[model samples]
Target: MVNIPRLPTATQAPQRPKRTDKQRKAEQAAAPVSQPTVVAKAVAETIKDPAFIEEVQARVQYDSPQGKNKQALSAYLDVLHQAKREEYSHLLGVDFYV
Candidate 1:
């Protein structure tokens, strides 16, 4: 047998009226949401992989940007490759040339 007190005793604080699950959710939904700071929001956004979103956003029947952007990617890679080749070109002296 459990001994439950009908009212709060002097040592105990009075409990506020119990709210239903629906009431609690309603109150939460009604409350103003605290917006994240700029840096925090940027971090949260950058952490998310938006590739899937971008792939779907175009709503095209054909291939995604991955395949279509090969030209642009190749162009960038060519510039990078040229820079790296030039950096090591000095090491390839004419003495080593046949």
Candidate 2:
């Protein structure tokens, strides 16, 4: 008889137990509401200022990242716009995310 190496079967592999819907719901219910940090709030306030926006617009150089500059600029503009939306942010509900 020839000697054969033993191999583990699928059932022998470790498995992570899936959470039940009730467990998931319980976790969601236990989660705390999210809020912005002081630094983030300060940044939002600074960006909302017309003078700061103008300064940032003037300082943004397309040469910094070539073709990707537009996306970066749009993101920067979005951050500035966030200050205006801060009060209504919670209205986004479940879709809210970082």
lDDT of each: 0.72, 0.79
TM-score of each: 0.29, 0.42
Over 1-98, each residue of candidate 2 has an lDDT whose tens digit, in order, gives 45457954445568999999999999999999899999999999998899989998998876555567877887998898786667567665433345
lDDT of 1 by residue, 1-98 (tens): 45568965456678999899999999999999998899998778865869856876677575534764987887787877775666566677423211
Q: What is the lDDT of residue 20 in candidate 2?
A: 100
How many angstroms is residue 44 displaced in model 2 relative to the true structure, after the best TM-score fit? 1.0
**Can you tell me which runs of candidate 1 are displaced by over 4 Å?**
1-10, 44-98
Alpha-carbon lDDT of model 2? 0.79
Runs in model 2 deviating more than 4 A are 1-3, 6-11, 59-98
With a 3 Å backbone cut-off (N, CA, C), the pairs that clash in candidate 1 are none
